[model samples]
Target: MNEQQNKKKWLRILGNIFFYGALLLLLFNPTAKGWFLRQLMEVGLFRPQIEQEAAMPKQPAVATAFAFRDATGTMRTTADLKGKVVFINFWATWCPPCIAEMPSLNDLYQQFRDDDRLVFLFINEDADVQKAKAFLQKKSYSLPLMTNTGQVPAQIFSGTLPTTLILDKDGNVVFRHEGLAKYNSASFVKQLKSLL
Candidate 1:
């Protein structure tokens, strides 16, 4: 082959190698990082998320409700809280997935807060009033809130924490979450909007 043709062939081969190698790297490291960095994050930073969910509320938690306040000053009772979609999330201060997922839940609630057809009652499984209050204050959460304070048993929880329990308008538990869920996830919003 001519010298120029050979040189062109070499350039094309090198270009193909670079392109295919980059594609392979992307395929192996789906976390938008290098494969090794992704693996490091999974083992280091992301492990806490998994560990937190694992440590979250387990055992049964009762379905009873107590009076609580929403973002507004109005009093809210379980009975009064019914209708539309009721997402009763029972979480504690220490649950990793619970904390990770609350921001999403808060966003979801705010998006639908003005809608009269929904109630996102984030129930605290903690009996300690002061601690719960401090935690809420620190987070600056303003959603409708309540606490069991031992009126409910852990046995009522289906032995899982980080469960986002969705109730129908009738207050029946429709869906339960046992893991981290995108608070404003498309599927979650769609399900909630559908119920409303």
Candidate 2:
């Protein structure tokens, strides 16, 4: 009986250690944390509201002064994107939330990639451009990677890790969502089509 009790005690101890170890890994590891958050997103949490025309808030136009350098060394500005529906996402390589939502954002980009009226900008906030590029390549994501070339207007982005903004054809900021969101939802795609 004593031997059986000892065996049971060891099993309980092992289970506790495994549980605590995984908890610690989730807390300390950025990649693991991102994967966990992504699972939450897959389960239908943190979805952005793609409102219909009647429910859409009337947001005023913001100044179009943001400039960015693309991976191919081409300079693009909000001015260049005038008369088009622009989708801009500000993110960083080190941000777990940004990593968590990238797959959904990439899916959304793929859907509108061939549409000339719609533009997608995946702006990287990392100090190292090479690292950002490598991250995308490693993940097999073909997002239009861009880096800031000048001052970013505060109204468009205020240092949020995963800030998403949508501009109408007339350069108005029509939609803004901060933090992780599943952007490839059917409603979101329909809304973008309506804007186009």
Candidate 3:
């Protein structure tokens, strides 16, 4: 074949390859519902939706400031707990999960309460002082009980009772558990012990 004719043929092949590749990319782009597009969608939006869903996210609120006063009117500022490992558990007087887990919670608190490097917060979610006080008296748990005064600190509860958050010494949330946790579950205990 003549050199000029051969050159033209090679050009046509390269042009076809480039054009087809561009068309494939545009056709399979996100919003096209194609497999590649679906992957892109999952990476761009769907994945986060699943991760940030109402379920327990890995990290809870650690850097945010939250305050609640003890029944005796003493103030507890979350900022003050920054250098310590902090566990904030949200409970309500009427919650069975909260009641059932009380003993274990107390045990955990007692073991770590005196440790200046660790702090535990038993935050009651909108539980009336009378009811909470009555229950605490019956349980004989000396841990401080602080009720939610209306503003949520981190939405850690997502408006539900019995959510728990664990913060590291640096004030970064390392664990978040939603719902009633078996206070002594191996996984939970392991995490707690690791913090200590």
Candidate 4:
């Protein structure tokens, strides 16, 4: 083949390879998608901002009642976890943003796993608990996984995947973030430590 024709053929082959490679990555690799989203956040494509509530009331303005089952099939309630810094994250296995932020959330959980003052609840919205468990096990994430059993308060989760709420010791929602964020960031840890 002539030089120009050979070059054109190679370019077409490279383009096809690139297209298929990206398709496979999107189809099968959740971690790769997570990494892509993280890169976007790093480049300021989307900033995950935490809006801190200035002076949360002593009592939760909205109902704080929520029921969920733990990993061991034990039913737990938000009321059962009163007087603790409860970190409740609503997420689903299929959510790309949720998957992206999960690693950071897991890191944050590891840092405070021993602290009785703090409680981390990774509420999986997936219908199948076994599937959710498998996903976590596959990722080797140690975050506590829970499934909503009863009515979850609208104040806590308004049908938004990857929503996170930080309740103070008094059961008051101090920080409610509705997107992916770097939960393991130093400043975020400092803010959480201050609450504890």
Where does candidate 4 stray beyond 4 Å? Answer: 16-31, 42-51, 55-62
Clashing residue pairs in all predictions, respectively, total 11, 0, 0, 0
The residue-by-residue lDDT of candidate 2 on 35-143, one tens digit each, is 9999999899987765633255555555745888887988878877888998999999899999999999999988889999998888899999999999999999999
Per lDDT, what order, best first?
2, 4, 3, 1
What digit string (tens of lDDT, one per residue) describes model 1 on residues 43-127?
4333222223334443222253445544343556665656565677777765655666666677878898898887677777656
lDDT values, one for every candidate: 0.60, 0.85, 0.64, 0.82
**Inter-residue clash pairs, candidate 3:** none
Candidate 4 has which clashing residue pairs, if any? none
Measured on C-alpha atoms, candidate 2 has an lDDT of 0.85
Q: Tens-digit lDDT track for model 4 on 54-164?
A: 354544634876888888989988888888889999998888889888888898899999999999999999988888899999999988889988598877788987899
Q: Each prediction's Cα RMSD?
A: 11.6, 2.0, 17.9, 2.8
Error of 3 at 138 (Å): 0.7
- Which lDDT tens digits does candidate 3 get at residues 126-145? 44677777878887987778
Runs off by more than 4 Å, candidate 2: 52-64
Q: Which candidate is the best by lDDT?
A: 2
